[model samples]
Target: MTTRILIAGGGYVGLYTALRLQRRLRRGEAEVTVVNPENYMVYRPLLPEVASGTLEPRHAVVPLRAVLRGSRFIAGRLTGIDTERKVASVAPTAGPWLELDYDELVIGLGATSKLAPVPGLAETGIGFNSLAEAAHLRDHVLRQLEIASATTDTELRKRALTFVFVGGGYTGVEAIAELQDMAIDVLAGYPELDAGEMRWVLVEAMDRILTTVSRELADRAMTELTGRGIDIRLGTQLESVEEGELRLSDGSKFFADTLVWVAGTRPQTVVGELGLPVDGRGRLVVDQAMRVEGHPGIWAAGDCAGVPDPETGRVSPPTAQHAVRQAEQLGDNLVATLRGEWPRPFRYRSRGEFVTLGKNKAVGEAFGREFDGALAWTLRRGYYATQIPTWNRTIRVLGDWLVGMPFGHDVVNFGSREEPRGAFEEAAGRSRVG
Candidate 1:
């Protein structure tokens, strides 16, 4: 009987794991099947550029079907796992949930935004986690600019121009920086609005931002962002975001139509519902070999897995750097297990960290070498351009970067794309009655 291997989640872990397996597994060794909601795996690191319209959304994602040619791709989510019977229940977008039996299982179901009890946040706030959100944010920002420019109401303009972002991590910082830069570049077109009228705020509960990198690098990032009139409130918390008004624990309150929450992420609820062993942070508990504890023939990796760092003797941080390394190692370990050989432990020391502060500006520390300004910015782009999977994506991303060099961000708002049928429906007098 052919061994059936099931992989869940098509983020970094799922894609890399399946890619490695396809390369090593022979024609008859095992049948690999992957289940994910989307047909493409987004290179999430470049999402900031997508939000700023610097990179096309299509180019930033690797097509799963094109890359994982050898594996059976299921455009669905793993709704449940019947581990006792080695069966996985997959809920596709249209069809009823079906169960597939597998000899081995690899759960890499990644994470989702972990929101707190801040009122109105659920309704008003958006996250920076997916391509949809990134694209929507780009259009949303441009729409806000339009509202601020054409409106004469001072209060409405102030609210439209105010942009508040919670979290000072790399994701939040890069997102706000890129979008802010886009806003600044487009401001020249608005004759009535001064750049000073726009407020960009970064709120962090910690004493510093970008704590994953060196303190010096974090301080440098703070300096650069503050210089651009970004309000970086250190050691502050978001008290509430009620009725388009944001209140901070520091006793500050403001009205802003845009609120981006990039605080952090927790493992998908399905990870916990699978009856697998998970850590305190709701991540799958994996041994050094990337195998889930007490679960034979099962493995987990990426942001959803609590992979141990051999160097630090602690769980590795949930970063793309770690996810890529862990997925590679996990794939190797699975192959070794299939071949009746000893599996290897995942061991990787990060080369360094990089944070982009808009175009041509960044702060990074890699290989014990610190870089700032254009040098760091160039290095950041070069590194990601090279590392992004598939030459097709790499070339396209570089092309976008090169083409955007001499020009400012495109201010055209494609918000209408969200409701493409709206115009036709209205013209036909078929608008839905409330």
Candidate 2:
């Protein structure tokens, strides 16, 4: 019997690790299979662009079968894992659960937006974690402009025009900056709504935006965003959400139409099912080799696994850079385990961080230097294009950047109308007839 290797969550780690294994292992050596909710691997770096209509939603996601080379693609979401039995619990797109037996397992289950008990937040807010969220935001932002243009009531117009983004990390900053920029451009198409009438606000509990970058870059980014009339609320936290009005900890309330939740993400619950040593954040504890400590034939990487940073003696932060590198090492280790060789430890250092503002504007800290504006923007694109799995994809993405330079962003609005699927009680009061 062939050695079966099961990989869960085909985001960065799942997709890349499977691809690496496919390339290294011989046909009869081991059977490699990937399990994910979707067949495509989203190029998460360009998600901000997708939300802003700078690139098509489909462009950011690569078909797993098309790019994964030679590997079995099981279109399913991993529900749980039995490490001792080497059987993974999986639920297909629309079916009951089944157990997928594996000789070795790679847990790359990824993370979800951390949702707290802020009233009405679960139903009212939109998260920017996946491609669907990006697409939904694009549609919703444009639709808000349409609503603003048609309304005569001052309060209604104000509500429709006000766009609030919570959190100012890379995801939050890039999303609001691009969407705000796109909304301004879209206003040109709607003569009735002056771009100036629209309010773009960024609320950060932290003192600065893009804390991943240098202090200088963060300061400059704040100045630039505020200069563009974006209301920067520092040391502010969201208190509650009721009747489409958001109340902040500062005792200020705004009846806003859009609220973007990019506060943070927590590791998937699959880690908890493993019953291994997990941190408070639900991340699996792994040693330098990316192996679950004291657990044989099982490895975890990406956002789901907590790989410690040797220098700081703390877990490494979840990032695409770390995930991709870890995936490569995980693949090598898994294949080595298949043979007689012992796998090497997984150690990685972050290259840098970058966040794109609007157009050719960006701020980044790379190679121990801070960069801003066009240079940083160019650097960001170049880095992602190279890191992306295939050259075919890189060429296509580079083409997108080139196309955007001359024609500008194409605003495509498609409203969210999909039926919410979950437990009946969860959707009972939440579901609305559109």
Candidate 3:
């Protein structure tokens, strides 16, 4: 009898864990199955570039079928798990629920934006967590440019041109910076619009941003952003966004059509629904070795699991670096457990942290050495290009970078992509009415 290993969530940890299992498990030793909501894993760091049109959206994702060779890939979500029966209930896109049996389970469902009860944020504001949003943002920004350039109404133009971003962490900062760069670059084509007239505001409730890295590096990022004329409100909060009017806690108000919320993320709600023992933060309670406490055959890691950092003696932060390291270690430990060998605890200190401040600009500390400008940017891109997985994807990303060097941004707005079936539906309606 072969052991069936069920891996949930095909994000960084899920995919990488399955990849490792497929490589390590001997033929007939075990069967590996991965469940995810999507068929591709979005390389989140490159989302800013995607929004800026620096890299095509398609290239920023790795198709699971193309990469996770020999593993069973189920395009769906893990709705629940029955530990007693050793089965997981998955809901597919358009079908009946599936109960997959397994000898062991791995959970890595990742997280989603943790939105607060700000007045109109839930309905009006958008998040920067997915590839779809990045693509939509690209089109949306260009559409705003078109609207501002064509309309003679000052208020409408102001509203269209003004872009507000909440949160000043890596996601928020990189997104605003890249979009701002794209907007400025494309302004040349919109002859009537002056870049200075466009308002770009960053709102953060905290006194500082990018708290993951050193204070010095964060200061450097602030300098780069503030130097570009972006309005950076240090101790600010979004009070409301009712009817396109944005009110902040600092007793200021503004009207902007675009509001991006990249504040932070919480584990996917399914983690709690799974009936597993999770921490107060709703992350699965796992041992230092990445195994779920009191469950010998079950394991979890990544953002969904509260795995402790061996060095800091604190739960590891939910980051790509930690996820990758944890998954790799989990894979080895899973194999070891299968063979009745001692499992090793996951341990790895972060090498460094980097923040991309748009094209040819970045701030980072690598190996205790701080860097800035083009060198930092190049290093950041180089590092990500290598880590994106598969030679084909790496080459395509590098090619995009090399080709983009000599050119300004591609300003063609494909907002029409958002409504692909509009024409077809109209045609069908006309035919019926005829």
lDDT of each: 0.92, 0.85, 0.92
Residues 280-361 of candidate 3: C-alpha lDDT, one tens digit per residue = 9889999999999888789999988999987889999877888988998999988998899998999999888888888898
| TM-scores for every predicted model | 0.98, 0.93, 0.98
Candidate 1 per-residue lDDT, tens place, 1-434, comes to 88898999999999999999998988899999999999999999999999999999999999999999999999999988887999999999787888989988999988999999999999999899999999999999999999999999999999999999999998999999999999999988888899999999999999999878778989999999999999999999998988888999999998999999999999999999989888899999989998899999999999898899888888998889989988898888888889899999999988888899888988898888999999999999999999988999899999999999899989999999999998898877854553
Ranked by lDDT, the better of candidates 1 and 2 is: 1
lDDT accuracy of residue 151 in candidate 1: 94
lDDT of 2 by residue, 1-434 (tens): 89999888898889889888888998799888898988898888899998888776777888999887688888998887777788989999877887999998888989989877789899899999999999999889988988988989999999999999888888898899999988887676888888778888888998777766677878888887888889989999888888999999889998998999998888876668767778778888888888888888888999888887777788777778888889999999988888889888887888888878988888888889888889999999899888877887888888888888887667566673443354565667567642
lDDT of 3: 0.92
Output candidate 2 Cα RMSD: 4.5
Question: Clashes in candidate 1: how many?
Answer: 0
Residue 233 CA displacement from its true place in model 1, Å: 0.6
